[model samples]
Target: MKTPNPARRSERSRRAILSAAFDLVAEAGYAKLTVEAIAARAGVGKQTIYRWWPSKGAVFVDAVLSLSEDDTGGLSLPDTGDLRADLSGVLRAIVDEYNDPRLDAMSRALTAESLADPTLNSEITARILGPLLEVTKDRLRSAQRAGQVAADADLSVAVELLYGPIYHRWMLRTHPLTHEYADTVVEFALRALEPAH
Candidate 1:
């Protein structure tokens, strides 16, 4: 008789665990989510979750990422050579995403937890926000080459300029996040990044 494929079983279990984590967080919020609950929901042993993830936060990050995976499996920004338009599109999309109730709840839960756990914060940065930041930086670099952005402009800070206000407004609920607001941010960012005379 052929031996059972342990690797396949492991992958299946991992997928199940991630899905369970996502579902639980969406249904009950992050505060109510627990490793034990994930195990029960996934039909796997608690040890199975521990074997792969260091904490519930890690599993949750992975779960959220898995659900948001695109067909390209990468966070891509539009690059139509019109930097202003591209930036507007990206920021508007971000506003749209943040406007989603499920995503808003999930983001708030993760942000709250990360404040208390430095390790989880690092994991969230590396696994969730890191790729998107890198992609945005790359897009800015392309704009620099196209002479749309100042050659000496600090790309890191430039990225912040584009996203910081939106993040600030969203986190603080200072104002409603909308596409028009996103476009306004893009306008300000473009002005700040305008090529030197």
Candidate 2:
């Protein structure tokens, strides 16, 4: 049999480790997740994991990135030409995903990891959150160019206004993030951005 390239084997091992880490964290919570356990679950040696990821937190961040595949695809907000519909649709999807038990747990894990390690937090932001936010900002800028949004509106601030409340509610567990709630958010944001009478 032809020998598999070492790089290919290494890539496979890394993917397995990340997948195992995500499943373990999702099922057992981050507090209980460890590199040894992840290595065992992935059927790879501990040294393999250590060689690829520096720490459990690094593994967890990789896991989060792996699990975010679906949410991260498309990455850009929909520009349906109707700003209201586009923003509402995107926000609704985000709210739904935010409320998912698995995603919620993963998010909580990331937050905890961030609190414990500033480096991990920066890594996560640069790799995951930052890309997502950049895509959102691009969509908002598109809306502005199309005259769907006001010219003077700050796209970054506007995107934050649309998403900040949803994150606040999700993190605080203050209110249910239902479709109705999403609709209300879109309505309020549109009203605030509408041209002055």
Candidate 3:
């Protein structure tokens, strides 16, 4: 019998691990998640998991990212050439995710875990939020080219303006996160980024 190659892991197994990690968090919350459980659920050895990920947080973050990224492992936002509509659509989807019971619990748990682990926080930012922000900035750059945004506008700041309010509302739970609320945030952000008249 030939030993399986350690350098080239089966993609199916990798996906199974990610799916198991996600389902475990959704079912039992992140506090109860463990690499052993993920390995068992994935039908792989704990050593396999350890070799692939440094921590359960890393596995879980990758799981979350797997859901958002495309087959090519890239993320993007819609660009209808209408900045307002595109941004509104994106914000509304974010509100919907925050409102989901399973995703809400998972997201909150990840946030709590990140607070205590700076490394995990950085990973979340770099792996998850960073790509999302960059893609959003790309969309904003397109809007700028279309004369929908100020040419001199700082796009990084523009992306934050688009996303920050919804993030604040979700974190604080001060108001119901709804599509209408998303549209309102988009409106305010667009006003702030309006091309210099």
Q: Model 2: how far is 118 from its true place, Å?
A: 1.6
lDDT, residue 161, model 1: 96
Predictions ranked by lDDT, top down?
A: 1, 3, 2
Query: For every candidate structure, what is the RMSD over all alpha carbons to the true structure, in angstroms?
Result: 2.5, 2.6, 3.1
Write down the TM-score of every candidate. Answer: 0.89, 0.84, 0.88
How many pairs collide in each candidate, listed in order?
0, 0, 0
Candidate 3: list runs displaced more than 4 Å. 1-9, 69-75
C-alpha lDDT of all candidate models, in order: 0.87, 0.79, 0.85
Name the lDDT of candidate 3: 0.85
lDDT by residue for model 3 (1-197), tens: 98888546678789999999999988987878999999999999999899889999899888987885452124347898888888887787788889988888888988987898898799889888887788788899898888888999999888888788889989999989999999988989989999877
How many clashes would you count in candidate 3? 0
Q: What is the per-residue lDDT of model 1 for residues 1-197, given as tens digits with 9 covering 90 to 100?
A: 98999999999999999999999988988878899999999999999999999899889888877876552123458789888887887788888889999989888987987898898799888876777777889899999999889999998899899889999999999999999899999999889999877
Error of 2 at 47 (Å): 2.7
Candidate 2 residue lDDT tens string, 1-197: 89869989888888889889988988887778888899899999999888877888777777776754544533346667788787788788878778778887778876886888788788877877777788777777776677666778876787778888988898899988998898888888877766545
Q: What local lDDT score does residue 160 receive in model 1, on the 0 to 100 scale? A: 94
Indicate whether candidate 1 or candidate 3 has the larger TM-score: 1
TM-score of 2: 0.84
